[model samples]
Target: MITDTHTHLYSAEFDEDRAAMIQRAKDAGVSRFFIPAIDSTYTNRMLTLEKENPNDVFLMMGLHPTSVKENYLEELAHVKEWIDKKSFCAIGEIGIDLYWDSTFIKQQQEAFRTQIKWAKEKKIPIVIHCRDAFNEVFEVLESEKENTLRGIFHCFTGTLAQAKQAISYNMKLGIGGVATFKNGKIDKFLNEIDLTHIVLETDAPYLAPKPFRGKRNESAYITNVIDKLVDIYQVSYQEIAAITTQNSKDVFGI
Candidate 1:
C-alpha cells in the first residue's frame, strides 16, 4: 500500500467531495494519510477529520512558516498548548518561508527555531516546510542538529547537496507532485539520491502532477507521483509503494 506522507484533505478545494476524494485515494492504494497543520485555525477541522478516519489519517500540530506573523508568539503558544494536551504524529509544516514575504523573515526564523526545540523536547519528528529559504532553513536545522532533531522536509525541491544535508540530519525528503512536473528540477536530481531517504506526499489542494498540473491536487493523485518514482528507480509499482509506505511508517511510527 502507498502512504501519502503529506496532504490537506481538509482544504476547501475538496470540501465538495472530501469523502469521495479520500475514498479515491484508498481505491488507488493510498492506505495512509499524514496531515499537516497550517495553523491553529484549522485545528478543529483537522481533529474532526482524524475522528472520522482514525485509522487512515494521522494529524500533526505546528505553526506554518508563512503563518508566522506579527503575533507569532500567540501562534506558538497555541501550538504548545496542543502539543501538551494531546498526541500528535509530528510537529510540522513548520520552517522558514521567504517565498512570499521577507517582512516576517526574522520572525519566521525565531518561530522555526523555537518549534524545532519543542519537537526535540517532545521526542517527536518535525515536518518542515522550506520554501525560497533553503539556506535559512538549513541554518536552523544545523543549529538544532542532534540525535533528537529529526523530521521530513516537506515538498522538497532542493539541490542534491541540500538533499544530502537534510538526510545528514536524519530527515527524509517529502517528494510530491513536483517530481512529476515536466520542468521540475527535483526529478532531475532525485535519481542521484537513494529511495530510502524519500517519503511520498501530495500536498493536496496544491502541487498537482502533470496532466493534472496547475489544477487542484488531492491524495488520489499521489499515484502519479509513485508512477514517476517507479520510472526513476526502474522498479515495480508495488516495490515503490512498499518502500515508501515503510519509509512513512518509520517517520510517523504508524
Candidate 2:
C-alpha cells in the first residue's frame, strides 16, 4: 500500500466529489492520508474528515506560515488548545513562507519556533510547509535542534545541500508531484538520496504530477509520482511504494 504523507484532501476544491476522489486514491493503493492544518478556520472540516474516514485519514494541527498574522499568538493558542483536547499525527504544515508575503516573516518565524516547542513538548513529529524561506526555516530548526525535533519537510523542493541539512535535523524529504515535472530538478539527483530518508506526498488539490500538471490535483494521481520514482531510483514499482510507505510510517510513528 502507498501512504500519501501530505495531502490537503479536506480542501474545498474536492467538495464536488470528495468521497469519490478519495475512493480513487484508495483504488490506486494510496490508502493513508495525512492531513495538514491551515489554521483554526479549517479545524472542524479536518476533524469531520477524520471522523468520517477514521481508519484512512490522520490529522495534524498547527497554524500554517502563510496564516501567520499580527494576531498569530491567538492562533497559536488555539493550536495549543487543540493539542490538549485531542490526538493528532503531527504538529504542523507550519514553517516559513516568504514566497507570498514577507511582511509577516518575523511573525512566521515566531509561530514556527513556538509550534516546534509544542511538538517537542508533546513528543509528536512536525510536518513543515516551507516555501522560499529555506534559510529562515533552517535557522529556526538549527536553534531548536534536538532529539525531540522530528518530522517531514512537506513538498520539499530544495537543493541537495538543503535536503541533507533537513535530514540532519531529523526530517524526511517529502517528495511530491513536483518530482514528475520536467523542470523539477529534484528528480535529477533523487537517486543520490536514500529512499529511507524520503517519503511520498501529493500536496494534492495543488501540485499534480506531469500530464496532470497545472490542474487541480487529487490523491489518486500519486501513481504518476510513483511511476517517476521507479525511473529515478531504477527500482521496481512495488519496491518504491513499500519503501516510501515505510518511510512515512517512520516519520509519523504510525
Candidate 3:
C-alpha cells in the first residue's frame, strides 16, 4: 500500500468531489495520507476529514510559515489548543518560507521554533515547510538539536549537501512532484541518498507531477511520483512503494 506522507486532501480544491478524489487515490493503491495544517482556518476541515476517514487520514498541527501574519499569535494558540487535546501524527508544514514576503521573517522563525519545541515535548516529529530559507531554518534547527528532533523536510528542493545536512538532523527528505519534472534537480542526486531517508508526498492542489505538471494535484497523482523513483533508484515500483511507505512509518510512527 502506497502512503502519501504529505497531502492537502482537505483543501477546497477537492470540495466538488472530495469523496471521489479519495476513492480514486485508494483505488490507485494510495491508501494512507497525512494531512498538515495551514492555520486555524483549516482546523475544522482537517478534523472532519479524519473523522470521515479515520483509518486512512492522519493529521498534523502547526501554523504554516506563509500563514505567519499579524494574528500569528492567535493562530499559534489555536494550534496549541488542538495539540494538547489531540494525538496528531506530526507537528508540521512548519518552518520558514522566504519565497514569499519576508516582512514576517522574525515571526516565522519564532513560530517555527515554538512549534518545534512543542513537537519535541510531545515526542513527535515535525514536518518542515522550507522555501528559499534553508540556511535560516537550519540555523534554528541547529540551536534546537536534540535526540528527539526528528521529522520530514517537506517538498525538499535542495542540493546533495543540503540533503546530507538535513539527514544529519534526523530528517527524512520528502520527495514530491518536483522529482518528476525534467528541470527538477532532486532526481539527479536522489539515487545517492539511501532509500531509507526518503518519503513520498503529493503536496496536492499544488506541485503536480510531470504530465500533470502546472495543473491541480491530487493524492491519486502520487503514482506518477512513485514511477519517477522507480527510474531514479532503478528499483521496482513495489520496492519503491514499500521502502518509502516504510520510511514514512518510521517518521510518523503510524
Candidate 4:
C-alpha cells in the first residue's frame, strides 16, 4: 500500500466528492492519508475528516507558514491548545514560504522555530512546508538542530545539496507530483538519494503530476507519482510502494 505522507484532504476543494475521492485512493492502493493543518480555521473540518475516515486519515496540527499573518501568535496559541487537548501524528505543514509574500518572513521564522521546538518537546515528527525559502528554513533548522528534531520536508523541490542538508537534520524528502514534471529538477538526481530518505505525497488539491499537471489533485493520483519514482529509482512498483510506505511510517510513527 502507498501512504500519502502530506495531503490536504480536508480542504474545501474536496467537499463535493470527498468520500468518493478517498475511496478512489484506497482502490489505487493509496490507503494512508496524512492531513496537515493550515490554521485553526480548518481544525474542526480536519478532525471531522479523520473521524469519518478513522483508519485512513491521520492528522497533524500546526499553523502553516503561509497562514502566518498579523495575529500569528494567536494562531500558534490555537495550535498549542489542540496539542494539549489530544494526540497528533506530527507538528506541521510548518516552515517558511517567502514565495507568496515576504512581509511576514520574520513571523514565519518565529512560528517555524516555535513549532519545531514544540514537536521536539512532544517527541513527534514535523512536516515542513517550504517554498522559495530554503535558506531561511535551513537557518531556523540549523539554530534548533538536535537529535530529536525530525520530520518530512513537504513538497521538496530543492537541489541535491539541500536534499542532503534536510536529511542531515533528520528529515525525509517528501516527493510529490512535482517529480513528474519535465521541469521539476529533483527527478534528475532523485536516484542519488536513497529510497530510505524519501516518502510519497500528493499535496492534493495542488501540484498534480504530469498529464494531470495544473489540474486539481486527489489522493488516487499518487499512482502517477509512484510511476515516476519507479522510473527514477529503477525499482519495481511493489518495492517502491513498500519502501516509501515504510519511510512514511518511520517519520510519523504510524
Q: Which candidate number would show the highest lDDT if scored against the true structure?
A: 3
Error of 3 at 217 (Å): 0.6
Q: What RMSD, rounded to one decimal, does every model reach?
A: 0.8, 0.7, 0.6, 0.7
Q: How far in Å is the alpha carbon of 253 misplaced in model 1?
A: 1.2
Per residue, candidate 1 scores C-alpha lDDT tens digits across 145-250 of 9987778999999999999999999999999998998888888878899988999999998999987998899899988998899899898999889988888888
What TM-score would you give candidate 3 relative to the actual structure?
0.99
TM-score of 1: 0.98
Q: Name the weakest run of 10 consecutive residues (lDDT summed) in model 4.
A: 141-150
Q: By lDDT, highest first, what's the ranking?
A: 3, 4, 2, 1
Clashing pairs in 2: none
State model 4's lDDT. Answer: 0.94
Candidate 3 C-alpha lDDT tens digits along 1-254 = 99999999999999999999999999999989999999999999999999999999999999999999999999999999999998999999999999979999999999999999999999999999999999999999999999888999999999999999999999999999999998999999999999999999999989999999999999999999999999999999999999999999999899
Question: What TM-score does model 2 achieve against the real structure?
Answer: 0.99
Model 3 alpha-carbon drift over 4 Å, by segment? none
- Winner on lDDT between 1 and 4 is 4
Range of the 10 consecutive residues with the lowest summed lDDT in candidate 1: 142-151
**What's the residue-level lDDT of 73 in candidate 3?**
97
